[model samples]
Every structure is written in C-alpha cells, then in structure tokens.
Target: MKLLRLVLPGLTMIAVTYGLARFSFGLLLPDIKESLGMSEAVSGIISSLFYFAYCVMIVLSTVITTREGPRRMILLAGASAFLGLLVMAVTPNVWVLAVGVFLAGASTGLASPPYGAAISLWMSRAEQGKGNTWINSGTSFGIALSGAGAILLSPYWRVTYGIYAVLALLALLWNFRVIPRAEKRWKVTFEKGNLSLKGIKGANSLITASLILGISTAAFWTFSRSFIEIAGDYRSWELSGFWVVIGIFGVLGGFSGSLIEKYGLAFAYKLGSLSIASASILISIAPEKWLVSFASAGLFGGAYIFLTGVLLVWGIRVFIKNASLGIGIPFLLLAVGQVIGSSLAGLFIGAWGYAPAFILYGFIGIAAVFIGPKKNKAED
Candidate 1:
C-alpha cells in the first residue's frame, strides 16, 4: 500500500502533464480557433508549434534526465507547465497563444523523459509494461477530461487552461514530496561530435516506426472530436463520451503490462498497429455511426498506447547504455511526423474529406509494419 501510494502520484503526474500538454490542445483547438477568428490551417500550425518545441527539447530533456534523474526533472517540468498554462490563460492574441503553447510543449518535453525514466527505475522489470501504460494513460485521461470540461464550461477556454495550470502545480508539489531523488551519479558523456543522422545507428527502424505511428495517431487524435461534430449526428457531450470510454479502456489496456512480457514487444506492437489500422478505417467510413466511432476510439487508444509502451521497453533493452537517448530519438521522430500530419489535416479534410484522410493515416500504419525490425525466429 505504501509503495502503491508512492508510485500512483508519479503516474498521475505523467498522465496529467501529457494529457494537458499534448491531447488537450486538440480538444480545445476548435473552440480556441473560433474565438480567435482563425482558420483551420492557422489553428493546425499553432497547435503544431507545441510539437515543434517538443522535438527541439527532446535532446535537452534526455540530457537532463541522464544528469539529474527523473524526479527533479519532473518537478521542474511541472513548474514550467504551470507557468505556460497561466500564460495561455492570460494571452490576448493568437501569436501570444502560440508562444504559450510552445512553452507548454517545452514543459511537457522536460517532464516526459524523466517521468519515463523514473517509471523504468522504480517499477520491477515484470511490471514495467503496466507502469509505463499507467503513466501514458494520463495523456488519454487528460484528453477526455479536457474535452468534457470544455463542453461543460463552453465559451470559457481560459477556465480550462486555469484548471490545467492548477493541476500542474499540484503535480509539482506531489512529485517533490513523494518521488525520492536519484542517489546514483554518473558522468554525462556525449560523443565528441554533432547530433547528426549518423550518431544514431540501428535506430532507423525505430525512428521509422515511430514516425508512422505518430502521423496516424496524431491524425486520429487531433480530428476525432471534430469528426464527430461534423458528422452531424452526435451531441457535443456524446463526442466527449467517446473519449471518456477510450480513456477507460486505455486504463485497462495499460494495466496489462505482464501480458507484454509473455508475448514479446514485437508481437504486441504488430497487434496494436493492426488494430489501429482497422479502427481508423471503420471510424472513417461510418462517421455518422456512434457505435463505430466509440468502438474505434477504444481500440485505437488502447492499441496505440500499448504499442508505445512496448516500443519504449524495446528501445531501452536495445540501447541499454543510452536508454534515454534512444527513447528520445524515436520521440523526436514522432513529434516531427505529428506536426506534419496535423498541419496537413485541415487541407486534406477540406480537399479529400475525412475518409480519404483517415485512409492515408491507415496506410501509414500499414507502412510501419515493413519498417520495423525483422529478426529470425532464433533471435526472438
């Protein structure tokens, strides 16, 4: 019970930070754009700024996580996120809002690596899958909560931002109180060279898979609510309900970490990726059907995040010496793909409609299967 208490707070902090930092932007984007008199393209770019900063901060986050350890990094991240959210709450213009988003992204970037590192450190090897899942589920929960909160408090996005700010502050406090600082210290080493394409070896497959996953997942996440709105059959709360259902299933999926241990990361990844591809197709073709969208959300949320946990574990195992750096590389690639996908989504939806856009995303997932590593049966 005592151990569970210590771990639960850390997991909650990660979930809250990720939920607000990444998923909330999509949930709140439509309202924010409308209030600011911006077009969908401009809105997409503004939201993409978060990912831009996130990608840039991955290197810094990796360094910090390696140096100071996960606990302190998380505290700093929470503080940064709090300030960023406050800035967004007070901003009067779109440009200012973009700056706020950038800061928020940087805060999350700082928080995520350390949080992931901390989970890896604290959880038993057998429990790592479930631990990571719980941490990741915070993002999904945040998304659902923010969406529901926005609908309940319509036309007052500032209030939602204020709520996020307060949550971040609480996370910061809890982290400092509960998470013990790392005692081990090691000399931080960087290769006497620039961060180039060549610095990363045998990481191509990971990066490629991450990019595909990012593009497809971001497309679904950013537009899922909007898709429901445009389909003209569901209430706003109903759309939010779908996300809430996804969040519930997400928690169930995340707690199945032990299952991944038995099945192997590669097998789990393949299954999750295939599930996402199928779910995307169903949701796209049957946009007006509530059950289809609801089922799709559950499957996609569960499978995508479950796969992420698997991949992170695999990366850590593959690059034990530079585990954080290895993890950051794939995240960086994921961020780049998300930015590209989100930026293009509005144009694609306008030109080709949601079905085609979803089809494109599904194809990206299918492409990932080929790019992933293929070792012999003996290697497994």
Candidate 2:
C-alpha cells in the first residue's frame, strides 16, 4: 500500500516530465519540422538542446536535492514540465520552440534524482529498487500516451501539445499532493553532494556504459520514426502504431528490478545492451519492413528502460551515501553523450543515410557492453 502510494505519483511525474515533455517532441518532430520549415541539421541542433538542458539541470538538481531534500526538487520538476509544455503548445518560431524543449528536458533532469532521494528516504531498502524501476517505466507510459495523442490529433500538433500541457499541470498537482514533505535538511557542502573523484571510485564502468548507451540510443529517440516514415512511406496510423508498440513493450522494463535481483546486475545489463544494440542493427537491415521496424522499436524501448533501471540501481549502490548523486551522475553523463550524439547523428544521416548511421551507433552500443559492471557484492 505504501509502495503504491509513492510509485503511482512518482510514475505519473516521470511520465509527464520524460515521456510528454522530453520525448514527445521526437514523435512530433516531423510535423513540427514541416510547420516550421526546419532542415534536418537545424532540427538536430534543436534536439540536442534537450540533452544540453538535462546536463545542466541534473547537476543542479542533484546538489539541491541532496541539500534541501527531495520535495522541493520534485515540485520544481513538475513546474518545469508544465511550463515547458505550455510553451511548446504556443511557440511561434524555432528559437521559441528551442526554449520550450530546453525547459522540458530540464524537467527530466530535475525529476529523476529527487525521486531517488525520495525512495531512499521513504521506502525500505528491500523496496527501493522496485520503486525506482517502476517509476522509471513511467517514461514508457508517457510515450504511449503521446503516441495515442499523435494518432488522434494527427497534424494538429499544437493541439496535442496543448492537451499535454494540461496533463502536465494535472500531474504536477498530483505529485504535489502525494510527494512526502522534506523531513530534514542537510548542511550544503561540495563533498556532501558526492561530486568528488573519491565519490566515484569503482564507477568507471558505469560512467562509460551510460555515456556510450546514451550516444547509441539518441538516434532512435531522435530520428527512428523519421527513418521509417521516409523509408517505408508509412501512413499516419502506422507511424503512431510503431510508437505505441515501443511504449507497450517498454512496460516490460518496469520488471527490471526483478530481473536484476534474480539474474544480477551484470547479467541484466549485458542482456539489455545486447538487445538494444541488436535493435539498431536489425532496423538498419530493413527499416521499410513493418515487422522489422516495429520489432526494432520494441527492442529499443524495452531495453533502453531496462538498462536505465539497472544503471539507477548501480549508481545508487556506487554512491550509497548520496542517493541524488547516484542518480544524477549516470544520468548527467547520459545526457552529455546524447548532446554529442544527436548532432552527430543528424550530420551522419545527412552525409550517408539512416542505415549506416544506425549501424555505426549499434557498434557503439556493443562496445559499451565490454565495459561491464565490476564484481561488487554490495551491489548484488
């Protein structure tokens, strides 16, 4: 019962911030580009802003959540999402749109670390991992909702974003009512936030793995739908259906906690990376094929969420003393990599095409597998 109370609202919050605010842009990008007269290069540069904002906010959120407690950061996250979505709904120019995207992305950065801190403070040790993974799966739910919205709203993307804004506002209120009050305040200090080299010992593998995965997955998140649309000439319904499939399968990632507990983090991590990498390669082979494309979306969505869940637990264990930093550091690196990857993928696609770009990214994901987690009994 207690778990449900936290996980439900937490999940909703994540869905709103990540799924609606951060990722829905990708699903809507084709329309947005058509409306705004954007080139692929311009779109990719704008998309990279999302990760750039995330990179900035994650560090700040980690430090603030560590010092002031989770409640404030959580509320701030919801507010950021609400405002960002509203801006997206009304943007008149690409610059305005970029501002909206940055705000929305910042919400995701703000949303994650506080939840890690919250779970640490409110939930028992046995339930913390479960709480983290379940809440993380909210991204999938949000994505599914956005896809459904895209199907129904079709070319009326402003209306879609407007509706999403209202939903974000509602989610913000829901979280405000549900998230626990800050119980205590810690003295703010540089060391307390765990940003030091000493704080990151034995975490080299986690850092490397997350950075690489971020780069590998950026193409899928930013351009996979565009690839399929161009290659297959898919109808509106089919394209949205592809997104819905990704979200539906991504719900499986909520079970990542169980997978990690049963099989161990190393095993689960490797499995997820392999599956995600394979998704990229598989789609590159025949993105025009309905089965192949949809399968790739499902594989990417499921494995992406599952791998992040594992990283969440892995980060928490590595920085056990500071839960916010545990979530922040890995996520920050992920965003950093994405910031680099989004622009590069855009250039690569323009230079070569989707297939080669995706294949190259797939090899990168496989490389991440070689930098596996160390044998840590405490984490196990």
| The candidate that achieves the highest TM-score relative to the unseen native structure | 2
What TM-score would every model get versus the actual structure?
0.87, 0.93
What RMSD, rounded to one decimal, does every model reach? Answer: 3.6, 2.8
Tens-digit lDDT string for candidate 1 (1-380): 13365457766676666777556776677678888888867876787777777887777888777766677677777877888888888889998998888888887677666656665566555555566556655666666666577668656788889888898888888888877667743233222122344544456777778888888777787777778679858976787677776665666556435665677556777777787777777788787888888888888877766766666655555544554565677777777777777768767988999888988888888777766545434212
lDDT of 1 at 266: 66
lDDT of 1 at 231: 85
Candidate 1 clashes: the total is 1
CA-lDDT, candidates in order: 0.70, 0.87
Which model scores highest in lDDT?
2
Could you tell me which 10 consecutive residues in candidate 2 have the lowest summed lDDT?
185-194
For residues 307-330, what per-residue lDDT tens digits would candidate 2 score against the true structure?
Answer: 889889999888888888889988
Off by over 4 Å in 1: 1-6, 39-42, 120-123, 184-202, 373-380
Give lDDT for model 1.
Answer: 0.70
Checking candidate 1 for backbone clashes, the offending pairs are 15-138
